[model samples]
Target chain A: MALKAPLAYETKHHLSYYECDATGHPSLSMLISMAVQVSEEHGNSLGLDTAAIQSYGGGWVITSYEGSFAAQQPINGEEVILGTRAIANNRFFALREFWIQSADRQVEYVRLTGLFVYMNLQTRHLMSIPQAVIEPYHGPEKKRLPRLAKARELKDVRFKNDYHVRFFDIDSNRHVNNARYFDWMQDPLGAEFLTHHQLKHMTMRYEKEVRYGQTVTSEISSPYRNENGELTTDHRIVVDGQLAAASTMIWYE
Target chain B: MALKAPLAYETKHHLSYYECDATGHPSLSMLISMAVQVSEEHGNSLGLDTAAIQSYGGGWVITSYEGSFAAQQPINGEEVILGTRAIANNRFFALREFWIQSADRQVEYVRLTGLFVYMNLQTRHLMSIPQAVIEPYHGPEKKRLPRLAKARELKDVRFKNDYHVRFFDIDSNRHVNNARYFDWMQDPLGAEFLTHHQLKHMTMRYEKEVRYGQTVTSEISSPYRNENGELTTDHRIVVDGQLAAASTMIWYE
Candidate 1:
């Protein structure tokens, strides 16, 4: 589903020089982090801060994320607005939409939708969403929530790579941050391909987790031409030869 | 001289989850990035935005940085105050101070000082700082600025390892980011030492640049006990058997 939300919370961020990768634009991980930051700001404004949620013995856990990038991306030293809001929710899942746009809001940079499940920090089990947590954002509380479409598996994978999990990739959660998987997915594609093509939309499905001291292999299929004649790529990650994550991207040549 | 600026330019930031490392504390690069972020905010407030600075045909280029960490560091989802100010400067170099503290400003997490030189972007040649650029900062201009204490060379090096520069390490400048050298310096120290010892203070001096696909070897000296009962370690990085960067760190047992 596309991200459609009335912008109720907005935060302005300055892109730092270090935030950019070898390319001039912001990295995928940094973009994802900015989205998460804006969402937290929105929550803090509504009194649903991390401590407030943790007070209930549970916290929000992202189950899936799908994002679409515009043709224009934010560059270093540019001011970008990161806005987010809770769009909808069900008994167990809360759907939020996030956007990164130019300072004037006239140009949108990217839009993202994330499915969050309430999980207990102690037991690490799924839990019901508390009413107090969702009452402020004023998102609809429906019984059923939409699930993100999964990326199709690669059938004729050509390129493959083995990546050693670096200390920098792992977060406080003791596992690799989900956003980092995007780097691995693109690393195998090489700088030549990434520099020529611009990413339009990408979907990430993290089925398993990669921990520190573990090595994961990534496989990519040759660029496929869609009906619209645009370029597309399929990616899959495996640990111990078991599927860990799958992703797909539509790129503009 | 140390980071003794009168704390004036301040910006509050919410550290994202992806900013943390395996040990659960904010990673070194992200901490340095946040410092840069606040410094930019300080510049923008003074009408010294990138566009305005570029009009002079030169921009602020960091020549060296020295930082010290407090015992308490922030974790994921924590709000921190990033403060920076131009304390002193000369015709060629500007000395600035930075700090990361708790939101309440009660507990300081880290303090840093950076030496910046004005450089012509096109020619990559060092240039004198324009008075118009330094005037808005309201910093004291003098004939000479304090230089950062150099990182002592390592001797009797026992531990050594090689790290191939990843494509992601390269920035828009087509070279590795200066802060990334810390990762290489620390990588050779191993996870066991990193997990136990806390970084209290460190000084880094960039002698040479590492490019993509280059293998850099890091050599670390044996642990030495200072008079104050603190631990100290010195490190040096060599590319093709030549010095690239060197660093020193003080750790508490």
Candidate 2:
């Protein structure tokens, strides 16, 4: 018998000029968008696409994310292979793993883990994953999966800036696109640090949904560029003066 | 014997949920992005993609746009075909036509025309189209091209709203994303009227480029709902109180 490869859904994506940022690298938001796209494709390949889940009056709602980026990232004009696989799941929670790697080179750009929960689309209440929906994946059950580091509690933030959520920020979900939060979080770091440093890893937790016409205030605690040479920061997003989201980012030296 | 395509190109795009607005349809900005995508794919097929054009020290710059919409637009989760073809060109001007239609039905969703000017990317000066850039396209020459109606001149503007351009609005071009102009123009109309009306047609002239951190004001003349049951309005985007862009819009009853 011939050797078989591990079961994982794959897609090839060519980076367009517009998908890049001033730095000629894919923006954080674009990275998330690509992840979402591959996940959708994976679901469809497994016969558990949006339509399949919707048949049960529910949908998969992402609850949190953890991403680890290689020191080098893919640049514009690069074609990358994006691979994703369902990792494991409990009754209410499903875990998936994703990676972006160079198609022609031995470079892995990033690795990602996403936590999603099944929810009733109408009532927005958490629900158990249907067997028919999960069966096609062949994902392991009760397998120990990668865990996300807990973000430091944010308080007494010193720097603050407000961003008015524009019409473009809202997606078909009638809420701000989750990736937009990275922009809000990073903008507070200003152009100096953002241009100088590259993100090594990040953990973001989406707490509340932001709507259009709302102003999100982003606050950051003064960074601790420690002796070990790693820079760490805590960030929070406040909407209408209420906490909407939070994250912690660690940057490579 | 065989026939050939009329120097036209097309690509099918599945409208993802994130591409849509709260109204469950693709947003105006996303529609424009799709147009840009198909246009790029068309150029790639013709061997005149961004890399190819930049190699000649030049690129195509959009000078203006005119868009017409069908009352019914494609909804989220639908696949639509985007088609574009070069209509005609002079030395400095190339006019192109585009249309968005349903994949399964005989319904046309929107039609657009874009006027482009060849320019030196470094100097931003007008240049003649290179033969290499135009050869593969096989677009006809001197055929009468579609024209956008000239926008009515603006006088003293009374009603106006100011918007501060956020950092995210800046794209790889180092300028405000052109689609941001539509949001700035429509927001001044307020939510109630925007929710009920649909844009029938619009002619927008890109007079000046807006930059990040700049504040621009959107001014609109009082709209007139005519005897034909159509609503017409004139809009101007003024940056630093100088006319940056202008447009005329007609809405379906």
Candidate 3:
């Protein structure tokens, strides 16, 4: 029997100065980390913690993310709300929604959704979602999950940077942290572009896990206008000529 | 007249998994960051915020840090208490003490002290501490502040690694974060040593600030036993053959 729980969970967080960038806004990586943290709390509230999930011989792995950011981003030292909800899931896939908002609910800073899959811990192979793990969340069962925006393949690479994954990059899961990919994906845009533009929307897909002691090349296409006339940039992370992850970002002045 | 404020300030923090290392303990860098956050809160509580201090044409800058850690450390998802108090200050130098302990106050995780000096934001030279800033803390005024352990000069360097400062490394202060030095100082030791050993004590001194787009060379001496029969390692961060920062760490199995 599933333990009854709230369909959604929310928590308050105080943004620290170290979490913000030079522009005084929360860095994208930190924002994503906050989202992940909230989701972990949500799961723990439902009594489905890492130990419980891994006991079924698998652990949740994020495959892709799609999100949008508002122009008025949260600043350092501000108290904000982090919320997450399980949207829908199937045997092989699960979808979750997340948001970051002002404490008074006056402003919406970020809205994101992630696609997840269960992976066997020892065999490193995809596994079906465990009944005990997914039951408590009470997400609707779906035969097919909604498709997220796929990262367009990188073409006409205009800039490239090589980053050697350091020991600190690996988190408790023993692989490079999922949120860290944002730093590598956008850093090659250089300080000038990063400072002048604000990220409005982003879509990222992870095809391979980056490990410690690996040098990954971050490649990006020059900023161009989309059909909606929004400035867009395409990014891809490659390791040893193999695509590790790819992302597309829409920016505004 | 100074505003009446508590001589010490304390706050509770929930340690996120991302802040911990693969060993399931808070990383040295994150522990230092937590201490810094608590001090900032302490200053803010006394109405000595950055703006208030910077109005005098300078800001507080850390010159050195010395600290010790307990055998039992806090783990991810644990709620811990962070506390800070002004120890003593002079016209040009100030010293602050910090600690991290269990919520129930049964176990002490870390105890640290930092030496600080006011620096002119424009001239980047030492400046006398402003009365408005120091008076509110109610710390005893002194003619000479206690000195912290100085980092030993690196000798017989056995291992070295190069790290490129990324855009994310620069915080709101616009320089590499003070906590980041710990990562650079210790990463060259490799994962095997880091996982098998725990940091028992550390002393670090900052000589120069690292900026964005700079590649730093982190060099370290082989671990050796000190006179107290404790394993100790010496580390230095160099940029262009110039010493930027240095540290000494004592570890226990």
Best by DockQ: 3
Please write out the lDDT profile of model 2 over residues A15-36, one tens digit for every residue: 7555666666887777887788
lDDT (C-alpha, whole model) for all candidates? 0.80, 0.78, 0.90
The Cα error of candidate 2 at residue B240, in Å, is 0.8
- Tens-place lDDT digits, model 1, residues A84-171: 8878898888989999999988899999998888888667788998888777777877777767767878988877878777677767
* Top model number, TM-score: 3
Return the lDDT, model 1, position A178.
Answer: 74
Q: Write the per-residue lDDT of candidate 1 for residues B47-161, one digit (tens) a residue.
A: 9887799899988777677899999889877888999988787788888999999998888999999888888876778898999988778677778777776777798797787
lDDT tens digits, residues B85-197, model 3?
Answer: 88889888989999999999999999999999899966789998888888877788878888888777778798899988988988877767889989998888888888899
Least accurate 10 contiguous residues by lDDT in model 3 chain A? A1-10
TM-score of predicted model 3? 0.97
DockQ of each: 0.49, 0.43, 0.75
Residue B185 miss distance in model 3 (angstroms): 0.9
Q: Every prediction's TM-score for the first chain?
A: 0.90, 0.90, 0.96
Off by over 4 Å in 3: A1-6, B1-6
Q: Which consecutive 10 residues in model 1 chain B have the weakest lDDT in total?
A: B1-10
Collision pairs in model 2: none
